[model samples]
Target: MLMGEFWGLGVRFRVSAMENCWDFLQWLGPDASTCVFASLDDPSDLVRASAVSRSWRRFVIANGFSRSLCRRICPEVSNFTRAVEVSSSAMNQEVGSSTAVEWESLVREHRIYSYLCRCLVSPEGSSDCIDRCIGASSTDNFPDESIENTLEPSDRVYMRPSYWSSGGEADPQVPESLIYRLGSDLCVVNEIKIQPFKAFFQHGDPIYSVKFVRFRMGNSKLPLRSENYVTDENEGQAAADDNFVWTYISPEFPMLQESVLQSFKLPRPVLCIGGVVKIELLGRVQKQAMDGLYYICVSHVQVLGRPLSPKLALDTSEASGASVLKYFPVDSSSVAPNGASRDDEAREPSRWHAFAATLRHLRAGGAWNQAILNTLLRPVQFAEEDDDSDEEEPYA
Candidate 1:
C-alpha cells in the first residue's frame, strides 16, 4: 500500500511538471522569447507562431515584434509610427474596448509592417506599365521612338521628345506629365528612377532634362473603355480642374543633366488609393544647341512598389498616399500576360508541328485553300531575339 501511494504521487508530480513545461512563456524568459520571435525573418512565420498558442500572440502584440522587424528591414517605414499612435488613441476612447482595441491595433500594425518588409525584400520585377499619358502637350513622338517605348528594355534608344517650336525647340516653363496605372488600387511605392535622353546623333548632343521633378497620386474618374480619351487638348488645365486630384504631392527635387539613371526616393511609403500616379517633369528645361530653346526628354522611366494583397481592405480614409516606386525587372519577356496560355511555351517544336498538322487536316474541308491552309499550319513564334548592343553611351 505504501509503495502504491508513492507511485501515484510520483505520477501526479510528473504530470504537473509536464504542464509547466508546456507553458512556453514560463520556460523561455521574456527576453529569450522576444529574441526567438525576432529571429523569424518572414511575417508569415510569425503569424504561424502566433497561432500555436494564445500567449505567443500576446507576446507578439505587446512587444510590437513585427513592427520592430519591419523597421529593421526597411527603416523608411518610420512614417508608420504616427499612424500607429493615432489608431491606438482612437481605440482607447471606445467604452469597455480599450484592451480589445489595443490588441486589434497591434495586429493591424503587425500586418502592415510585415507586408512592407516583404515588399522591400522581394525581387524587383517588370515595371508596372503606365496605362496612359496625361497632359503631354507637345510630344515629338518619332515612329521608331514612341512615348510607349520609354518603358521597353530594348537596346534601341527609346525617347519621348516635346517640341515647343518647329526648330526642335522646347519651352522651359511648360511641364510634361505622364500618368501610370498601378496593378492594384492600393499599393506601396518606394522609389522612382528616370533616365534623361541625350540626342547624341545631333550636333553638340544636348541632353534634355529638367531642373527638378515632382509627383502626385490620385484616382482618375475617366472611363477606361471610352473612345474619346483625354489628351493634350486640356494640357493647360490644372490637375484639380481635371478628373484627377492630387491626394499627395512630392517635394520638387533637382534632376541631373546626364544620361545616367537618377533615383528619387519618397519621404516615406505611400498608400496610393486610386491606383494612378502622375509624374511631373517640373522646372525649367535644359538648353538646346542651336535654338537655345529648352526641352525635356526622358529615355526611360521606372516605378517600383509592392503590390497589395487582394485580401487587404481598400479603405484609404486614414492612409497616407506617400509611398515609393521601384524599377521593373530588366527582362520583360519573362513576364507573362494575364490569362495567357502557359502551355504554349512548354510544348516542343516537334509537338507543335504535330498539333498544327492535326489542326490543318481537321480544317481541310471545302473553301479551305491550300495556301490559306499552309499559312494556318505554320507554327507561331513568340520569342524575341535578344539584343546585346549598347543603346546609349554614358555621359562624360
Candidate 2:
C-alpha cells in the first residue's frame, strides 16, 4: 500500500492529502479486490494493504484469497496466535446473527488452523509457508503441517551432492557454496549434505549468508556444520548461535556494533503476512566477536524501491564475480547516477544514509540498537594494560 507508506511516513496526515487518499480508495473500492490480488506482484512491498495493519491483516486472513501470502504475512511464532487470535475472535464476536456467528467461527477456525499449518509446514522465515497455509483446507492443513513442525532443523538441512572441495590435511577451504537468490532479498544457502534453506523477511528482501569463517593468518578452518555439530536435543544452542552476524569492521567503533540495532525503510509493496516483533529489547546486551560481528536475530526488509527493480535483476552472466545480489539505494542521491527522478533520487541518499546513520542516531537517541558502516577511516584503541606494563613508561 504505497498509499499507506505515504500515510505511515506522515505525508498524508495533511487535511487535503488524507481526503484525497480516502476518496481515491472509495473510487476504487469496487476495484480494490482486483488491486489487492494484483498487488502480489507489486514491486514495493509497502504498497500492499495487507502490509499496512491488523485490520487489513484480518481481512485477508478471513477471505482466504491470498494463499501465497501465508508464509510472509503470518506473525512470528511468538506473536502468531496473539495477532490472529485477537483479530479473529473480535471478528467472530462482532457477528450479530447465530448463523453468521457459526459461519464466522468456522472461518476463524480455518484461519487459525491455516496459520498453525504455516507455523508447522513452512520453512522458518521462508514465504513458502504462506503459500502452504493459504492453500490448506481443513481437510488438508493438519497438525503435522503446523508451523512448529516445520521449524525442525534436521528437515531444514538439505542433503544433496555438491562438488565444492572443502577440507584437506591443512586448509579445508571449499569453493564457497553457491548462493541462489529466491527473491530480491530472499535466498537459500546451498550447503551440500545439509538443508538448502535460507529465508529473508517479508517477500523478496535481501538475505545475507556469512559462511562462518574460522581462520586467521595461519590456522585450521571449521565449517559451521561439522559432521558432529553438537547441541541439546532441542538444538537451542545451535539455534541461538545462528543469529544474524552483526559486524563492526572498524575496531574503534566497537560500541556501534552492539548486540542489537534498528532502522526503518519502507520495503517493496508486497503482501505482509506476519506482525513485526521488537526482539531487541528481550535480553541483556553483550559484546560480540573482535570484528564487532555477532550473530543477531533481527527483522530486515527487501523493499522494492523503483530503482532496485532494474538494478537488482539476476544476470547469470555476472554469477562468477563479486556480484551484488541486490542493492537498496539508501539515499536519494545514489539514484541520480542511474537517472531516476530528482525527488525520488533525493530521498535515496537519506534512505541509504539511514542504514549507516541509523546507529549513530540510535545511540544518540538512547535507543537500544547498533548499525554497521563500510570501513573508510576508523580509530583503534590501545590497551591501557600495555601502557602500564611498559618498562620505559613515558614513550615506549
Candidate 2 local lDDT, residue 133: 9
User: Can you give the lDDT of residue 216 in candidate 1?
Assistant: 80
lDDT of the structure predicted as candidate 1: 0.52
lDDT, candidate 1, residue 336? 36
Report every candidate's CA lDDT: 0.52, 0.25
- In model 2, what lDDT does residue 272 have? 18
- Candidate 1, residues 175-194: lDDT per residue as tens digits? 66656655555466777887
340 in model 2: Cα distance from truth in Å?
54
Query: What TM-score does candidate 2 reach?
Result: 0.21
lDDT of 2 by residue, 290-331 (tens): 233222221121211121222222111233322112222223
